[model samples]
Target: MRRVVQFSTGNVGRHSLAAIIGRPDLELVGVHAASDNKVGRDAAELCGLSEPTGVIATDDIDALIALQPDCVVYTALGETRPMEVIEEMAKLLAAGINVVGTSMVWLVTPRQADDWLRAPLEEACAAGNASLYVNGIDPGYSSDSAVFSALSLVTRARSVTVQEIFDYGNYDDYEYTGTAMGFGNSPDDPLPIAFQLGVITSVFGGLVRNIAAQLDVELDEVRERYEPWYTPERIECKMMTVEPGGLAAVRFAAEGVRSGEPVITVEHVNRLTSAAAPDWQVPPEGQLGVHKVIVEGEPRVEVNTLLSHPVLDVTEAGCLSTAARAVNAIDWVCRAPAGLIAADDIPPTEMIRGLMW
Candidate 1:
């Protein structure tokens, strides 16, 4: 069993902790809590488990490193604090601990990432002879593995696109849905942080670049666009309410252009309610969320993935998928060379070891 540590206990982090504790191949050694209230709490209390695992949560970084875990499942908040997350992962890598995480979307394809984001981690990996792998649902599986696998069935591929269609009504994080996503804000107001200059490109652009690299094509440039929709009437969600004319839905895309044409694209259609954006794309059969990958070629291919949980809604199931991707990568990452490992470096789905049911 590979000794492992789970960092953070938020929505995705909680799932990571639970998975680590439940998986027989991984031994849970420590938990890192981001907030003071979470500190000292049992791993069970934090992850909604019925039993205790004896592991307590801590905010102490050095203590976790001292445990000498083979890898750390990092699911901290990276959207807003990318630099800080990078530094934290560097410290862990430099301490000789491998890391597999859902943080740092750009790191999904580190070779294509800018120097500002990739250099430090490379140096840290060299210093301690460790590795780092990052992934999630959209920027994780849907964009990379699913797309590449689908392309394998095609004769001639012209373009590739990945779309994330989500209804944020069930998402409980108000700060994320309301503020970061601009759900409850006015349509005329400046774009939300998520849509601000270069944000979408920074997050989803890696997906575009990754496709280009796999196809062995050079991108002339990466471009982004954001479109927001307003609610006709007041719409109430679990997190917050959107008044008439408030931002209720958004459609954004980051395109990887080659020779002045977009050959690869990552798009997202996010709405607070089904009725909010009638004109934009919606999940098939009125589902809450679905990830779709389309490859335009002679033998056109399309794959749609819907995640569901026994007790959780589609939004939370999405989080579970994210955690599972990182947790499942623990063993593979531990055996890889010391560097930032991309999804292409890991074995295919069938070869990876874990629960089949």
Candidate 2:
């Protein structure tokens, strides 16, 4: 069995730990946590596992490294001090431990312009002959897997588009509330401008470019637009400042083209309140919400029009799926050709199947 160490005690780390512990092909060797409360707790209890092992969590990276596990799964937040986490992962890799994580923003090259993020990790992997892979549900699977799956049905295409809608009511993180949808007051707040721009230039940027490259469309410029919805009244939420009827809707549009011809158009929307907008649909009775993917082109296609599963819970499945995908790719990452890789580069079905065993 391949021995693995898990980092973090957050939702993602906890759920992933459960998945890893349940897998017969893998063994949970150790657990690491930054929280003082979590240290010295049994790994199984940390994940609510019925069978508790005597393994205690530790804050020391050296302690985890000393265990000499085959791999380490880093599920810390990529937005908060992500670079520092990457450095730590690099350290583990340099010690000959394969590193799989969700901290690196650019799972593949080109998504990021600076080499500072990937350089040290690559160098460490090369030095230790270890491998690293990063993935998540949004930028990882939703865009790549869902989009690729949609493309499978279409033989010809003039353009393609993918849309994701989620109700943000259940989430209560202050950081997510302020930055994710741009709801609070801050001098830096351009409403959703920054997020919209980043989506076009970062997450879906590479996908659009890759699509154009595949279609042989030598493009010119890519443009992005943002729309914010505010209620004449106010809506009260634990995380959001919006009163009864307030501004709780944000949409980002990205358009890619070649020589002024549009090749792909993508839109992402996040709504905090169900009644925030007329077009916005609330979760049906006994349902969480819906995640839909619609592709428009010469031979139009739509796959998973409305995905209503427990996996849509950002705190639960969102983070768990991301960490699980990254962990399952540990082997491929260990043997991957030196360089960055995208979601499309990794097979989702295979990754999921591997996690199940």
* Per-residue lDDT of candidate 1, residues 198-310 (tens digit): 98888788778878878988889999999988888999888778889888898999999988888898999999878789788889985898999999997999999999878
For candidate 1, the clash count comes to 0
Model 2 clash tally? 10
Per-residue lDDT of 185 in model 2: 36
TM-score of each: 0.96, 0.85
Task: Give the lDDT of residue 252 in candidate 2.
Answer: 73
CA lDDT of every candidate = 0.89, 0.68
User: Which candidate comes out best when scored by lDDT?
Assistant: 1
Best by TM-score: 1
Model 2 agreement with the true structure over 17-73: per-residue lDDT tens digits: 887788887788899988888988899989888898777899999989999998888
Clashing pairs in model 1? none
